[model samples]
Target: MLPAGLHWIERWLPGFTQRAQDLGAVLSGTATSITAFDGRLQAATHDDRHVLLMASRPFLEARIRERVTALPNVRVVRARAAGLVVREDEVRGVRHADGVVEADFVVDAMGRSSRLAEWLGDAGLEKPRLERLRNPINYATALFERPTPAADLDVAAAIAVYAQGLGATGLSVASLNAIEDDQWLVLVMGYGQERPGRTLAEFRAACSELPGVFAQAASGAPTRDIATYHQGESRRRDFTGLRHFPARLVGVGDSVASFNPAYGQGMSSAALQASCLSAYLTSGPDLSVPAEGFFDLQQVVVDAAWSVSTGGDTERLEAAAGIEPPEEVRRQRQVLRQLLEAGLVDPFVARALNDISYMLRHPAAMADPALLERAAAATSATPH
Candidate 1:
């Protein structure tokens, strides 16, 4: 999976510099030309909106493993997941194939395939309400040799292809992430019924269809064949709304909310949820697990991610399902559409959007008094 922007994550998890010492540079306007609102290719950097770090999953995972194990009372275990352990409605621990391990508090960070709902039922607790937005997406990714660094560019190209919900098919990104070694971790994304090719010809065609920089970078050779991942929808189990849910247990990552991969939010959302858990542990009710408080904070994180992702999904839904988005959702889309159109021309809007996308600011903060006024002026000045 791709890594999130560094500023926020670096704040939470220090020592990134030493861990991924060879991490690549950020993709800013200064880095390479980027395709933005209405297919207008332009530079990607601004005052607040700039490139973040570029690192690979293995590099990050290794660092995380090292850091976590170094903790005073932390143990790193490799075990097959069986299910949760619970007494009445409070979760006590986990049950694996070999044996059962107990804990004062438990967390389920399993991804889209999590069986938390089934575990709850097995433990005689009511299952949380599950919500889903169907968006069949398929894509494949592989590592390739990194290109020679471009003149005047920081690292390499990171092209973002935004959909605006107009096309039934939306291109996600051409992320040619320059990583630790002289390798580029490139991912090609597609939506709805479209699928990334499998055969050599198909894969080459898919690569050629991406932005020029990505296509040229991958034109050389691939470390592996095209691999495909499929998911039907974005889902959330509404544990936060349950009054009698289990205590001493929390759901993180996709067990809580699995956003459509097209939005590239799964990891970032989980990190934000991790921060929420840390907040509760550090400051809130110490001994007794503040499960409710954690859920409350976690919900805020999920809501923001869901809004951004579902905003794009709803557009696809309209095309795929022939159902109209709610009036509020439509209005929000219209406002955001205007913002996107004006953002490239307006510096303030660009910074606001970049911060929101990077999770440094709340999505609702898109409506800041000054931002709204500036955006409106920019939109009005445009010849739409």
Candidate 2:
């Protein structure tokens, strides 16, 4: 989780972060920095004040289940939701194999394969507009026992990105995180035709070709075989713009927007959306009408993540197709490139870039005159 998401979780569920940390979750601090490489030079940044949490998906899920099931008002149910119980365009409950479970509000958390749209359509409600970006990204991840103690690792996380003229050799992106259990979770990603291999030998060879950190992490004894996944596109459903929507029903998490996982924004985005829902409910909203307020708050988080993930994918896709972007886009890319270059040697610029990359700040923060002036000066003074 990023700092923004972690903050909200701590706010709503007090002591959640501390409990996770006590149970061996790795928290970002002065000793844990995230380093980024542009196929050449590298820069590192860390947030000592607001730290992020790192843990395996299963571990996180188990922790959440433990906390939620202990709540007095909450009951854990094991059943499949076959359909929605809609009454006069408002969802009243859910239908399962056994019977129906009623609720005042229904949250669609079925992830990317959610059937909410089809259900809504069957109920004679207007479907939300779906937007998709064809990314065609493939990822392969491997687990390894850390070669050294956690304290001795150079950085907690590192990412090497493919740049146009930086001598990249078919590798799109490579990253490794020092996760819990003294394990290193390393991943390598590629575009449509440049998929990473599934064999252990192929994984090690790819790591060797990447930066030093990747090779070092791969040197450790393998704890698990390579696991692979493919994402065809990044997508979002425009729920706010829909005219005929149901009341007492809302969507969260991947049901709203699922971006490229390479950016590590999925969980954070969902957490922030939950925070938005909390805010909307606390504001005493009208339950008879649509959840426009929640959707509006959620849109801001979705847009920030979409821009960060899709912006890079679109650039790579366009470049591979031998297509040049418009003049305005070219100018914007140029400025961004300058800021990235400046980040290598300037601490302030590096932190700013890190904040933006981690979704702690919006992309518009890059346009601050102070940041632009510093980036310009740093770019001029630094040597490539």
Which candidate has the top score in lDDT? 2
lDDT of candidates 1 onward, in order: 0.68, 0.83
* Whole-model alpha-carbon lDDT for candidate 1: 0.68
**lDDT string, candidate 2, 298-365, tens digits:** 89999999988898888889998899999988888898888888888887888898788777899989
The regions of model 2 sitting more than 4 angstroms off are 44-46, 164-169
RMSD to native, candidate 1: 3.2
Count residue pairs with overlapping backbones in model 2.
0
Residue pairs with clashing backbones, model 2: none
How far out, in Å, is residue 366 in model 1? 2.4
